[model samples]
Target: MATYAIGDLQGCLSPLVQLLEQIQYHPEHDTLWFAGDLINRGTESLETLRFIKSLGDRVKIVLGNHDLHLLAVSHGFGKLKRGDTLAEILTARDRDELMDWLRKQPLYHYDESLNTVMTHAGIPPCWDLHKTQTLANEVENILQSDRVDDFFATMYGNTPDKWSDELTGLDRLRTITNYLTRMRFCDENSRLDLESKEGVNTAIKGYAPWFNYPTKVPHDCHIVFGHWAALEGKTQQARIHALDTGCVWGGSLTALRLEDKQRFSTPCTLNRKKT
Candidate 1:
């Protein structure tokens, strides 16, 4: 049985189906790992959510920033931006069940057997694997608890742009969430530069992609992430894989088979629509 790690779906179910067919996936024997952003922007958000949810144990998913935005919008916390195609999902009959499943999804997924870790975005250089898991759980518990509304109320900021052990409450949770979901570039000191969305070369002065930042603690496991579609599935590092190929932005949908690191892709057939 093979395991495939797919990039952001962003509500593009057709491409995902095509990619799975190309890989000749057998759900009974094979497993799928999604880099998240499962819904939003693309045309079929509702269908994508239902299909992925139906996969059950055959698939694993982490949460992306867009996914969180959907959660917040569902609860009247966030406004729908101009190009958002999430209305179908919000109006679905199973909207409650889908959103509940999404909120409970972890922000980080680590597979000991594969020796790989997956997140929607890069992990901060300051966090080792153990610390990463611990911090992820902290937010996960809050998201799945009675205080979830409180967390969502304060989850939309970029303050405290750096990680610190002394940070508490919403500040701490927000920082962790950003690093795992929205982070792309950071300074040598691990201060996240959230504004720079361009490719690696366009990083602001004194900043570099989060994966390139220096770390006091080292993590040996491979990292698989999907947020920066600008990279187009290229990190130039063997262990660091960028799976998001911008399928929602008229690029190709990609997947990487874990056992042999084989890459598979299907061209996006959706109309070129910006989000």
Candidate 2:
């Protein structure tokens, strides 16, 4: 069976279908690792969610910021935004089922055999794989509970920007969610800058790409993430792959063949309007 890691789908289903066809993906025999942001911004959020969710065990997804935001909005913890394209999902007949499934998805997934760790955004420099899995379990518990609305209600924000063992309550929950899904840059001290999404060279003083910080991440493992489409699918660091190629913004949808790391891309249908 083949395994593929794909960039953010962002509700752009047409390109995703074409990409799968290009790779000759067979749901019965292949696995797809989605780097996340599976919905939002594009025109067919409902169709995209239903398609992926139908794949069931054949697909693996890590919760992206947009994915979580959809959950938050579904629970009435967050409001719909002006440009949001998630109305199709929110208003879908299977909204309840889909949202519940999304809530149960994990924030990080690690594969020991593949020597790879996958998240929607890169892990914090301060977190080793073990700590990341532990913290991910913490949030996962809350999300899996019957009363997870309490967690989602407080999940939005940029406060408590620093990670600490002492942080508790909603502040702690939000802080963890931010780091796992929204993080981009960090200061030299390793505190999440939260606001900066620029590249390493253009990052403001003291802020560096999360993976570029001084501490050691396991050099033997590979890191795969999306978000920060402005990275335009770049990491400039070996074994670290940035897969958000801005398919929603007229770029191509990308997929990385897991066994050999061979890449295949399909030009986005969003860009085909002019053709």
Candidate 3:
């Protein structure tokens, strides 16, 4: 049974369907690791969520920034932005069921056998594998607890801009969430550059891609992440896969077969929507 690490779906269900066909995905045997943004910004958020949810144990997904935003909006804690296509999901018959399943997803996933890890964004450079998983669990614990409502209410912010073991309460959880889900650039010190969303070339001075920083993770370990569509599946590192190909912006949907490290892509046909 092979495993395919896929990029963000972003509600582009048609391309995802075609991509699955291209990859010869076998639901009963093979596994799929999705780098989040499973819905929103395209045209079929409801269908995409339902389709992924239907796969049961065959699929795994980490929560992306968009996924958390959807969770917050569903709970009436956040507002929909201009390019959102999540209204259908909000009004769907299975809305409660889907949201329940969604909120239960973790922020990171790892396959010890393959030494392959998956998160919506790359792991923070300062964190070792153990610390990464531990800190991720800190947020996951609160997010899945009775305090979830309060978590969402306080989830939106760029403050405290860095990780500190000394940070307590919601601030720590929020920082962890941002690093795992929203991060793109950061310093060697792990101070996040939350505002720069452009490509590496445009990253403000002294800030480079998070993957550029030295980390405690062994060099051989593979990290599969999405979120930064501008990379177009390029990080120039064989072990690091940046798989968000901007399918919602008329780019292609891409997937990496973990077994052989072969990459497969299907061109997207959706019209770009202004955000």
Residue lDDT tens for model 2, 40-157: 8887788899999999999999999999999989888899876678888888899999998998899999888889899998888888898888888888899998768999888888
RMSD of each: 1.3, 2.2, 1.0
Clashes of 3: 0
Query: Please, what is the TM-score per model?
Result: 0.97, 0.95, 0.98
Ranking by TM-score: 3, 1, 2
User: Could you say which candidate leads in TM-score?
Assistant: 3
Query: For model 1, how does the per-residue alpha-carbon lDDT over 1-275 read when each residue is reduced to its tens digit?
Result: 99999999998999999999999999999999999899888988888999999999999999999999999899889889998988888888889999899988999999989988899997888888889999999999999998988888889988889999999999999999999999999987789988889899999899989888655334567889999999999998788899999998899999999988899999997763365
Candidate 3 to truth, TM: 0.98
What tens digits encode model 3's per-residue C-alpha lDDT throughout 141-243?
8877888999999999997788888999989889999999999999879899999998989888888999988877888899999999999789987789999
The per-model lDDT (C-alpha) reads 0.90, 0.87, 0.90
TM-score of 2: 0.95
Candidate 1: lDDT of 209?
A: 91
